[model samples]
Target chain A: MVSHKPVIFVVEPFGGSIRWHNPSLPLIYWDDYAVTRGDGIFESILIRDGHAANLERHAQRFCTSAAALGLPEPILNSWINATQAAIEEFGEGEGKCTWTYSRGRASTGIPTAWVSIQPISDVVLAQREEGVRVMLSERGWSFPSELPAKTLNYAATMATLRLARERGFDDVIFTDPDDGHVLEGATSTVVTVKGDKLRTPYDDTILPGTTQAALFAHAESQGYRCKQKVIDVDYLLAADSVWLVSSTRVAARVRRLGEDKLKAPDNENEIRSLIDAAMTRG
Target chain B: MVSHKPVIFVVEPFGGSIRWHNPSLPLIYWDDYAVTRGDGIFESILIRDGHAANLERHAQRFCTSAAALGLPEPILNSWINATQAAIEEFGEGEGKCTWTYSRGRASTGIPTAWVSIQPISDVVLAQREEGVRVMLSERGWSFPSELPAKTLNYAATMATLRLARERGFDDVIFTDPDDGHVLEGATSTVVTVKGDKLRTPYDDTILPGTTQAALFAHAESQGYRCKQKVIDVDYLLAADSVWLVSSTRVAARVRRLGEDKLKAPDNENEIRSLIDAAMTRG
Candidate 1:
């Protein structure tokens, strides 16, 4: 069940040289206090045909998120080059690479950054093919501003995912407690087609999925209606089609939620074309 | 500004030889990955007259918190003895020691186990004598049950402290968003005297402060009324005296909050005596 061609790459601190733990294994610096403390920021990107998909947007967001956490920005071009070198070293492939930047190690009690790349899991592709079952889980996020940027404090999200798995669901959907607005999935942005409009939660509460943003932009350019708005559970249940979007998964449709089953979209081909377009964007 | 004599100690991880990078500096394995990733637990204990204060309770909570995080308990007695040896090696009077256990490094993802011990800062003694000002900050904690145990994920608490310091305060008091219940300080317990009754926030929303709990038990035996219940900002403002309790500070009165200045407690001698008795487990 390999998702794509196999590839291996090294993760280095933002501006550092690529080294390996062993001559054969890529050296990733996990010695930093940040990785344990979750005191860093990261972005997941897709590499297809040796090009990083949505690299600029991912880098910009990563920088912004890092700034919010008071971390120095990793040299984006160096990271890109390092990632490219790793990808080339592993040979050509359709896979995922995660770029993580922590605060550099100093006496200042911040984190030192590191990055790692691995082959995308086959289960992601399988879910893309078969769609997925999701459960609504309380992540306890009350304010959008509090969670605007990505931080390493992800234990709550992990707990939600664990609970979702225990409950026999493939993924979890989080909501804002103040107004019960459907926020996003644990690791993905939520998008749904209601009648003729594609809608997503409008706020900084969740990570803005690069794939979802690009897909929505492409959808709008192609004369498909798209919008960002507060989505309630009732609105989600009545949506024509539900999709979870991320860098790796692209666009995974929601097959069943709780006891209610959903029908596949009539515009499934168009949605895939939008995903393909997103993947091709630099 | 050094108000107390220094006693220092170092501890090695269970089953590991005491390694030192330099003869004077003990090399302790700290899973920075575990600490930054919030994949570890830690305990701070007061060392007085060459003995760790509340050795049994501190060791127990350290094990309990680690267990809650799915980590196996390290050799508690060995670690304790190692600490004592370090203190003996360094000599002792009044100082603080921290024992931290993290899930060690993982091949990938997160770690499974690691530990370290180090001496506390000297500034803690200064704060004890001069008193400290605290600022009220909102943590927006809506879900209490999910975060019952202490983890390395302390970014929010750190942020609150930074915010407080930026506004000219030494510490911050966090409150619940749902009902405006005063929870506790970012790193200490909140205790205030309202008339003859000593009150603290209930134990559910915050970590059970060892020093604060012991003080309450000792206060009750000394004929001071003690109560643990939900307290709001208004109650805190109206208290006869407000103090923050922790391992290092033991107990320090809050002199001012925002624009409101509080008078030093009339029962200062009695309160200090109670705190001393509690520290001695009388």
Candidate 2:
């Protein structure tokens, strides 16, 4: 049996209209800043029940990310339309979608923007079910505050993940080199639960996690207190439960931090149910 | 009048063969890690006197960078031949060539590699002649030692340059945020000259600059003392001359660091001549 490719769309200049694009053909030039310098912004969103989850929040963050990079204000209508079209074609129950907005070709100032939708893979499901063993790695330096854009510059992150895999772990969480405080996971925001409190690292040193924020709101409605602060290693290790949360992988419980093993929290099923409800509602 | 485009070539898998590719057409897919995650490495070399300057040194650094990213070891012969072919077609005199090797599409584990040659723009020449007004900006954080690679994660670099331009400067010199010491330029290495001494910061915290290394070698043969050490603001301000050296720009003298104006040193021409000799010989 032949496999079907994911749905992809390319948005025109000034966010005019998005064109259905062939995934097999090339879509960007060599001189585009996206590839040449990784000078652009992107967002990954979760699709569920034929709808994009928390798209508004993702779009807002996408705009903020673009602004940080001095990119033009994105046309939300165009992006929303493209996302909807892609999902409609994908015919999905569960999948992930991503939007890439680049600085365009060197010769032309027009931006290159695209959206792609793909079904969620089995590995992600397995990660959710079995949990992940994680290691702590320092992200030595930080980007200056003046340009606090989470642009497409993830070489260090990827390298750190590779280092973790080599060391026989499922993922890695980055710590601030200066103070040994938790920053984030390679591709997710980290949250720790202690009793009724849900704590995540402060957004000052990392990208604000859309899924985490949504889950926090839902948990708060369920009488769970939520706070964002500087998280140290000891605080993480002492938590009753820890989760690596992102758009696609809604919540993957951390089974281990370093050599210390962690057990599932007493309310693990309840928390998962809350996350599902939050994502589905959004 | 219709304008001509730069020469570009795409390398086949395993560096088998290179085909001249049209710069106007899209050459990379949306899902390629080069664009998605900046999971790649690149090197820029200066083309001079009908040949690529310091081809062997650049290739060596390329391999080192690839290793840092856990990329497949580069085929040196293939890269060299492609560089020669591109130089031959570019047809002599003052140009810049870059090689980009990226982790390929998400579905395929094969790598994507390409070469492109473009003429040096007049703005670069102007910066060299008139000198640049540089502002000091802190890079805030550093990457961990295990992943000490200079991949195509240039978003911060480009943003820093943009911040400088907005503040009425030509470029930026990034300082280590923790201690307020010099790191390097946004795209080049920092070198300061006082009397007959040449000093650049130690390479441990930054990408080892190939141009700075070559220049120091040539300067040493010419009886100029060279040292690599931690450089503070006071030391940088007190230098008789400061230069930002790189592959494409060769050496751009810094006329102003922050608000303090500086005069061109007595042996500026002699130093330029030495640089020319070093590059031509290589």
Candidate 3:
């Protein structure tokens, strides 16, 4: 009955073999701390033409996230091999491949690792092609010495997105509560473009964006000056254009921030090409 | 091979019958949002003498947490029933019973719910009996209007505990980053005792602790003045005695808060008995 369901590959005991199972089958112990305490780290990468974009970078960030949680260091080669296995099965076209590394059952002390592929939805594609209207929500805190890890504890992120959707927006831009410094999007990194230079928020408070980094690296090589600093909301508001970038959505221009309308990216085609080039580069 | 493993009961769906499965048999989908995004709500209650303590209160808080995440309203009766089933199987003695409800697979829109029972570890019992030495860790944020929800997104909570443990402390009391107000413990609620008054931080910024609430009620009924206020670190430091209260732990006396020694609760026996009576009342 579940033959048609997509299968996820489990990486057995980091640096070990891989096994595939149908999604319908139970795959995680009930007491796995990932589900019990959100005690885990994860990474998602965009796949195009059977290629997993930024796999290396994503894997590095995966390790960084694990370090943040004090989890045992992940065997990067195992993750890469497993992600590739999933992507290979996904074949051509755009899909999102996510790596979930969970602190397994407390008694076991072993970690549960798996990779699953999901097709990018029409809504996401539309947002990528057009733009997204966003609302500003407060993250309610700041980390001056370390960025929040890209952990599986994303309840706030999910809630923020729900809040925006309820208000008739596609996503949200989180602003620091103490000061209205534009932090990042609910699931993506915030980027602003003004004239010749491209800018994004750089601080110990935001998750360092994998897609943003890739895009910036490509853009910088292409002679599009890029800068990262603590960004004020006003600066974003006054920017020539804005975009929310991530592994799957790639780069979705911000059509509206709150009630204020935002201009489309001045170099839309160039920006798309740069992102595509970066994604395809690997 | 897994016959001796503890079993977890899955609620077929809210308002449906339950089925038990061994934890080793894998009870959750790999993509369940509870693991994927930590998008879920859960509750843990102390099971004493075959009774699930203050279950009604736990269920209510469970609903509150679900509401915070904009999840479908839980059918509380099913949770209560499932919890009772697990506790009954545990039978005669103290244990920890946890209820987990995840916003199931996105495609299904059906929430996944389950209950599991665990024997409370001796370390926890010792903490409850001998008191805990705690350190103050900054929560790194302030929520003045709405207390953080007890959601599945507990990466920060787990990380905080890890940090405390690394420093050789049993637990941590989080202080408001903005003003150093005493907040709550990573997995427990903070309470202070001074003279005859029992006080705990009261605000939208802390989880409304179920055990703490029950303790306060029992204490109030006994003519011990109980106050809920926005307590400061100074107040807790000057407190004659302090406690970190939770479901399974009941009320653990704070032997030390940072470097300062705390006097053992003048009414230690009374406090323990009061907590026991409240748990037994249900």
Candidate 4:
């Protein structure tokens, strides 16, 4: 199922529009602005067969995050249309689509919306097959209100990721400094499978990932026990299997955590089955 | 000096260069792009007599902040030339000039630079004479490294300021959550006169205000003792005089804090004298 590499398409809703400026400059510039300033909120959705997977859930999350940040309501229909346009422009591809909105520019110091589109890199697809080795890092210093929203202030996460990458790790798992409880990954949500029971962190400190939520629902329907509870790093290391879920990478198994190599089932078919279930729902 | 309202001018480095497909729309509509995402850093300078006050310091701080966030450096000479061009385009005035840079329209995630100029608002100038009321709030959730860089993640400050304004205050004094020590103001540095000594918070949790540093130097030369220490909210309220210092406002007394009305001195001339001395050094 993961034979071919997925190519994700990124789109910026306010990018190509000429309502304000000449749409001559590619939306890539606007995307760069979003990335640099962390000034906006973004939602990433998996795309399969030219349709966004769990798009409504992603859109609702986007709106909720935007509202929390006091940003104006994004025109969801227009955004959907923009996403469709981007998909059509890029053609059918297996990957994710991201949409971002910022407060518009005004002297009042409010942000306006901006958007962009990009293709997923090959390395992201490679992680699905080879799995990932992650290290627990104490970073993600954020307020409660800010945790759930995908705001652009990802400097801390970026710093941690850079450190993790330099230390020969694919990703970093953030833990609460107060008690050493696992929070989430820098760009993805964490799910640990102990036998049939799956547990995730229950807090606003991490994004409520669309893919994770869908997987939870599917797991429940399949009579698999799922719980959202605060789990310490010890529990995570002790878990039988740990998976990181995001819009782009559905569920990548954690093979090695720190120095401890955990026993993961060689059930690639089961993992692919879970992803297929999500794709069907998509 | 406070008898008449001051005039302001707004300039953009990309003013003529900004290509707009829709001329009827406001320039702000174009801002909906990445610049608003706070993916950039900015510096605000007070321009007096056709010259930017503390131009070097402002430029250096701007560069430092940008570098901290991994943004590409703005060409200093080009920036100076562009700023001069902007000022020349806007002519001379007693208002403030703000230079904002976003990672420009480059494909790189790092910000290039975007510059905009605007006149200082009358309300900001009004506070110079009328003084400002402040309320204390918590800014404990942020990390120390993030505190040093003036990235666009100002949501916390903005929220505090909004609450302060709603409560009939000019701005907020952020306090440490652990011990309730006063950190700094939302837009300015907090300084208090206790006996003949001037004191402010000493920590990387606040932007090292250039104006505050200058004030310390001027105060020392004027035979006033200068100290940097952890100050509690209670101590701030009990100080002999408390002032909010920034480049544009120079110095403004805190007339009220929470429920307590301060007996602050209306020695605007003396404060201006010190500010003028510091500006001369710039």
Candidate 5:
């Protein structure tokens, strides 16, 4: 029996329409932007119940990123419909839909785009439950206040994560390249809870973590005195609890930060209860 | 009569064999590193007359970058053989061989690699003659030392170039995110000539430009002093000549740096003569 891979819907280089990915064929030109430059912007949205969660926000952020990268921005509805096409083909029960928009083939230099939907991997799902241990890399460098949040370029980010993993940690945290202060996780935002307040770095150095934003709002609603401010390394080390949150992994409490084992809050389940509700809702 | 496009060769995820890209097929998996995470490092070499210029140097740099990214070292011989395969299949007069060493399919997460050879674009060729106008964008920050040069991720680099082009410049130069000192070009290294000496940045903040290295060596052999040291913005502007050097463009003289339109040297052709010899040899 022939096996059908998950559908990878692609738009023509000029962004006319969407078509299903052919398992028996090559969809992109050999010199497509996806191959040559990785010169594109992408967004990954969680698909729950045949619907893209936080899609409107994701759509806006994607457009912002695309605009920042100066790639042609796809109409917001095109993403929804294309993602729908992927979902219809995948028969989704909790999957992810990723969209890549680029200036088409590197040879022809036209503009094209695509979206792919697949079930979230078990390793990713496992992080939500098991939490994660993270080490800090002094590579505090970050893109300036401008530039897109996420682009196809994950080299430095993934490299940092790989270094952490090799050193027996789950992920690596990038601190401020100058001040030695905390900046962000390889793929998530760092949030800390200390005393009666929850705080995260307020600067634009990192991808404004979508999950973190939702959690911040929820925390405020819970009257936990949330603040978006500079998070120094000393304060982070002294925090009662720290979590790295993103769309996928949802929230992975940092079981350990560097060599020091962080202590979990006595009411850890209560905080998690809030995280689950925030991730799904706001 | 069907017209065949340029060939794009792909390797299996396990890096066993190579095959020609079929127009009627998919070259990459739905979950390939190119598609999902862009979790890969790559190297591009200029090929002329069946020769890959600076092959050994590019290979060594790739290994250094791969190691920095904490990836399995791709056997150096594999790259050479693959380049040969791509060259033979493409029958290259003047093209480039691009090898992407990826952590492989995002699903199974096995290591995958591929190579493609295509004629260098006319835009790149054009830059060699007409020179280029560059605008400074301090936003294009990179990691300090020890990251791969040609990572699949290129958001910030491309974005700054876009911004510069929008403002009616050919390319963008990156500057120190903190001090606003010049760093490097989007895809090239900054080399300036002052008095009897050739100087470029010695620091680890930028990629070691292969073409720049060759040119510097050629300069030294010709009895010119060369130095790799910090290049401040003031020094850059005061230099007699400044050029952006890379593998493909080789060396494009900077006609305009920001608002200042600098005059070209009387012996510009002499410099070009030296660049040509340097590119083909060292």
Candidate 6:
């Protein structure tokens, strides 16, 4: 009933091959932890112009995530092959190439090894240019750093974003519960620029945003000093310019941090190009 | 090919009706949040001697969780009715009545209102009597209390349990990274008794466990002083007697908390009775 239907690719065992999924059919079992308990790990890579950027990094993260969740070693090549197959069929479009390991069904040790390619909507892309309105809300405690993992637990973040939308913000910014330090965005990373310095939170309490890392690496190559450190809310507010970075969002300048207006960096376009360059790097 | 397969029941909205599902067939949509992102809320109630015990409590918790997740208000009656139908089909056997309200597919805003019944195998039930050995591990930071909501993020807890299992422990106990205080278990609650006091972690950092609440109520009725407070690791290790309580496992005494052996509570049978009474209470 909708235009541009999503193309799904599910991974099978050794001899099993991935295929296009029928949208109307049920794809997961009744008891897979991915469904019942959200007991799985996933990755979403941007597929731009038929290329899934940073797939290897994503693959490595997926393996690390699998080990973190105590699952069997992920068949990385199988996933890359399957995702590439889907992307090839989806040729030359902007979409997210996603994969998940849901720990599968509880009954027979069902494995949730699957991948799909879904279009990135125009509305989300608009945030990349128009910039995003952000609000700093108390995120209490986050999913702790001792665990550098993202399980299927998007409920709290979804709820937070929903609340933020209702209150007229594009996205929400999470702060440390104990110290009110800037942690990260629900689906993005926090980066700030002051003079020639580019800084972001290095603590493990947040997802070590790959897109943010790419931008920083590119920035360092360009002679901008880049460092990872804890950023307090006050420090964030007082920064010269702030931006939220991620794979999908790429680099979005924060127009406002709470009630304060953030001055745009003189090198906004230049910084963005660096981030874009890293996003597509192999 | 399986003996004693689980019987599943599903709920539907307008133009939809509740029904039983084949154990071997697919039950979740590929796009449903439950499958794709594990974005949903769920509850599992114990069915003993033909009754879905404490369903009202579970219903209330479900509603609370829905609110916490900022989803639409749940149609609690429909859930109760659906569970009744599943229980009727299963007849007299120990099983869990499970219900989930996944945000559903990202497109169409389709609501995933479903229910299922799965039998509790003998091996799992044995933990209630034989007790469980638990190890303390750092959970870094948890989804903080300001939210008091659980999203589908089960990644860290699953990883911690997996590590503990590899080390031969039945379950893993989480300690706060900052201060090493006891937090809740992956799927259960923590409670202890020392002298005349019944104590459990009162912090909002952990789930407000319903079963644990009932135990406290029953304990208070028996004239024991009940309290909720931060339980440090040392305090838990030194506890007179500790137990991890939940709806399914009921009350499992901590045979060993870390390397310290907790002498059985002089009142093991007494504590069990309290837990049992709460398990079936409406």
TM-score result, candidate 4 = 0.83
- Can you write out model 2's per-residue Cα lDDT over B1-282, one digit (the tens) per residue? 213248887887594698888888899987899999999999999987778887777888999999999999988777777777887777757778999999989878889998898888888989878889999987775655666666898887888788899999999998877788898999999999998899999747787888888888888988999989999879988998899999889888999999988888898888777777777776
lDDT digits (tens) for residues B1-282 of candidate 5:
222245566665345566666533446665666645667778878887778887878888888867776668777666677678777877738786777777766656677677777677778889888899989777545564556456776656666677788899999777776776678888888888877788887666777888888888888898778888887778878988888888877888999988988789887787777777887885
Show model 2 residue runs off by greater than 4 Å: A1-4, B1-4, B13-15
Worst 10 residues of 1 chain B by lDDT: B20-29
What is the lDDT, from 0 to 100, of the residue B10 in candidate 4? Answer: 23
Task: Estimate every model's Cα lDDT from 0 to 1.
Answer: 0.67, 0.86, 0.80, 0.67, 0.74, 0.78
> Model 1: per-residue lDDT, tens digit, A97-118?
7766655342344444444455
**Second chain TM-score, each model:** 0.85, 0.96, 0.93, 0.83, 0.91, 0.93
In Å, residue A177's CA in model 1 sits off its true spot by 4.3
Model 3 lDDT per residue over A1-282, tens place? 112235488988656688777777888888789999888888988878778888778888888888877878887777777777887776667788888888888888898888888788779889988889999988764432332567787776787788788999999998877777788888899888777788999766777899988888888888889989889888888888888989899888898999999876557777777777877774
Docking class of 5: medium
Please give the distance, in angstroms, between residue A261's alpha carbon in candidate 6 and its true position after superposition: 2.9
> What's the count of clashing pairs in each model shown?
19, 3, 2, 25, 8, 5
lDDT at position A135, candidate 2: 90
Would you list the rank order by lDDT, best first?
2, 3, 6, 5, 1, 4
* Candidates in descending TM-score order: 2, 3, 6, 5, 4, 1
Which parts of model 1 are misplaced by more than 4 Å?
A1-37, A73-75, A103-111, A141-147, A177-179, A194-196, A266-270, B1-40, B47-52, B55-111, B141-144, B177-179, B194-196, B266-270, B280-282
lDDT of 6 at B58: 78
* Two-chain complex of model 1, DockQ on C-alpha atoms against the true structure: 0.25
Candidate 2, TM-score of its B chain:
0.96
Instruction: Tell me each candidate's TM-score.
Output: 0.82, 0.96, 0.94, 0.83, 0.89, 0.90
On the 0 to 100 scale, the lDDT of residue A203 in model 1 is 62
- DockQ for candidate 4, please give it: 0.26
Error of 4 at A67 (Å): 2.4
Candidate 2 vs candidate 3: the lDDT winner is 2
DockQ values for all predictions?
0.25, 0.76, 0.61, 0.26, 0.50, 0.63
